[model samples]
Target: MNNRWLLPEYIEDVLPEAAWQVEDVRAKLLSLFKSYGYELVIPPHVEYIESLTGIEGDDLNLKTFKLVDQITGRQLGLRADMTPQVARIDAHLLNRMDVTRLCYAGHVVHTLPAGHFSTREPLQVGAEIYGSKNLTADIEIIELMSSALKVAGISEMNVDIGHVGIFRTICELAKASPQIVDQLFTALQTKDLPSIAELTINWEESLKVAVLALPSLFGEAESVLATARLKLPTVPAIQDALETIERVCVHLATIGVRCSVELGELRTGFYHNGLVFTAFAKGWSNPVARGGRYDNIGQQFGRARAATGFSIDLRDILRGLSTPSGKMSILAPDSQEPELRELIAKLRESGEIVRVDISGGSSDELAWDRKIVKSVNGWEVVSK
Candidate 1:
């Protein structure tokens, strides 16, 4: 019977109660975006492999699941992320010169699960702003993302900001070979200070000290920036990088949003040209949401718009959350009575869930809250 009982690992069904949670959050979040003038778009699930693997999509390459097309006999890949797809929409599809605010909510399948998020499939809900390089645009996207988590019942959320520009610029000034750059990138990612020291042994004194200090340049915004300004070389690129991070922090504070700076975070070095960040709630070790500025992501599509955005896995935010309560329902007898049918229709129109009981005895399929009963007056609702 082809192992009907077995299913793939990391993929499972959402029962009724859990489905209700996902649906409720989806409705609330999409409505929130619409209120903010961010139009929602749903790109195709699969596309020509090249369309998704543009310069911006390099980070997603290893995560994408590719397959052969049956009709065209060409290669196709399931989208691992939706940012590039939205970039294409802004660049090629809309072709608007003015700013474009786009938001999306959909399932993105990955070849492997990411840290602590064991599911290979994630429900990514995000918002992006195009054609605006001002820090305001970045703040707006971050605000929207922070608000999303709050609305999802997360509390005490702090957004930790970073900049790929900080490290990228430092590396450029060090003039390290590509091979050395690769090694330093890995060493920094893992915070292997010994390896980082070893990699920077040949660089000039100031440059070497700055490269080694990069890993420790993380904490509350002012404190980290203070340390960076004193300890790191005062090169133009490093100065500009620090300035941008401070500007983002200032903007976030004006909006009453809590944020900190972490200079080592280069989540989008492959695509991001400026700032990057991750969002965390009080209790979680891993970020509940993450995003950054990847300006010129649409360059591949010929527009080259400046852009920034953020996204969160809807499923992960509610991972520890219990399934929502079942639908509140009223039980009624199955009958040909016109009056009873009319009553049911009225209840349904009033947004009440009325289920007709087909079996004479009780059925355990539905968790009905009330039952309709005949009375001297009109029908009465009795507690179940």
Candidate 2:
């Protein structure tokens, strides 16, 4: 016989203990977002393929699971990321000109795991700020992300910050072709200096030196920024990128959040045009949170709004935290008596977990610490 009950590789259920933790943490995060004036949005699990993957580039497209809708025949895709959907809502649905704050929590399905030990279905929790291009927006996003992790019981985390525009500006100056840029981007991700040199062999000396220096510009925020300023050309765009990183890092430092700068950290993908960051907890091997500025993302939705945000996978955060203790429940006998029913209802109303024994079976399998028994005092709870 076949083991038909097995789940797919990289896909598994959130059992009771984990599910409770996920819900508990999700509630706290949503509450936190709300406190920050971020209105919550619940986007659909699926949408037109264009709306989901149009601006995020080939990486997101590869992760999305696509299928033709039965009714309209238009292609539909399981959302791999909700940022694009939130952008659409802000652009088309809300259409507000002022700075809009939106937060979302939902399951995003990916065709493949993002990493070796990752899940295909991740409960993504995120907050976005639109219509603000100020560096303050980036600062607020980073601060909010730091606060979010702390609220989730992850107090010690390193925020690895980078600016994609730094590399993009250098590439533009070198007049690198898209293919060459793609090759260099892959190499830089791995800090492969040899491959970077090979790719930029034909480039001018100055441009090649700047490109090669990117991989080495990784360390403490202040020193890295200082080194970057000294090594990189004083082009206006590159300087602006460096300044942004400095300003954000300084603010994070003031708030007691530790951060590092990685000039070659462009893992956020093509759409993220500016400041990008990843939050790594002490014990976790993978980033627990990621977000950055993707101003052009709204352009695809017919409105170009300056946007910044970050998302945390609840499962990832849960992995680092100890499992939440199971809630104690009270066992009650299944009965039709009005008084018994009233007592159970009253107990439930008072924040008690009441599990009625409808099957009249053994209580050994039940996770109940107390029981309701008919005694001298109408109906009373007693230790089981």
Candidate 3:
């Protein structure tokens, strides 16, 4: 027979030590989010296909696992991303006109692994601010992202910042066709200079120069911003985008967080409209967290709200840290004596891990490192 106990590809169980570490990180991050005034919200694991993928576009649609609802005979989808579901809640459920901040933690299933060594199921933890168009809101979200990672013991990280509006403006000015725009977007994402040159070879001279300059317009935020101002067109939109990046960098500097500007980093899907960011820790090829402004996403849900947020995979964070040590537990004899039971309860109440020896087994077979024995005075804990 085939290995009946084997798990599917890219799916594995989180054993005891790692599970405890994940729980500890999750609790700490959620508490940090709460301290910042973001209310917690739990969106369901499955949602109507339209509700889940409607706002995010084809990327999310392709990643989502779909099924038919037996009761309603309508299509349903396991959420590949929770941001859109949270957006739906903000738009339809809350129906609040004022600013709203929401945070969530849960597992999201992907049809395929994101990379060669990635998991299909990730514990996604994130926070989003809706209805605030102010740059301060974005700053606050970034600060929260930094703090959350630091709380998870990842102190040294780099935040790469970019603005989609920069590329959007360049595309509009060039009047590039949909086919050419898509090709150029792919080339830019990989920083493929030759493809960028070939794609823009026939475009207007000024626009061609700006497009070619994009792939090189990354590095220390201040220097990159200055070079972009000089090399890129002086259109209002492009100028505004650069200014926003500069201001965000200045704020980050005050907090001692390092950042770089990448004008060609437009990998986020079509939903993002403005400033975008991704945080990376050393030794990980993929980003630890990513988010951006998607002002028009809520419009698909019949409400237009200015939004920005970031999400990190708790499992990803766990992989970067050392394995957690086993927790020591106290063993209490399974007995009918009221005093023994009271003592066990008191030990547990004092934050001790007490396990009752229900099978009357040796302490070596059990996980407990200590045992309770009746001393002359009363029941007392002793080393096994």
Give, for candidate 1, the lowest lDDT window spanning 10 residues. Answer: 51-60
Instruction: State every prediction's TM-score relative to the real structure.
Output: 0.93, 0.96, 0.95
Model 3: residues >4 Å from true position, as ranges?
A: 359-361, 365-367
lDDT of 1 at 142: 84
Candidate 2 TM-score, true structure as reference:
0.96
| Model 1's TM-score against the true structure | 0.93
Runs of candidate 1 with Cα error greater than 4 angstroms are 56-58, 177-179, 254-256
Which regions of candidate 2 fall more than 4 Å away from where they truly are?
none
Question: All models: lDDT?
Answer: 0.84, 0.91, 0.89
- Clashing residue pairs for model 2: none
**lDDT of the structure predicted as candidate 1:** 0.84
State how far residue 90 of model 1 sits from its true place (Å).
0.8
**Candidate 1 root-mean-square deviation in Å:** 2.0
* Candidate 1 lDDT by residue in tens digits, 100-216: 999999999988887664578888999999999888898788888878887776866788888887777778988888778767776777888999889888888988888888889
Return the top candidate by lDDT.
Answer: 2
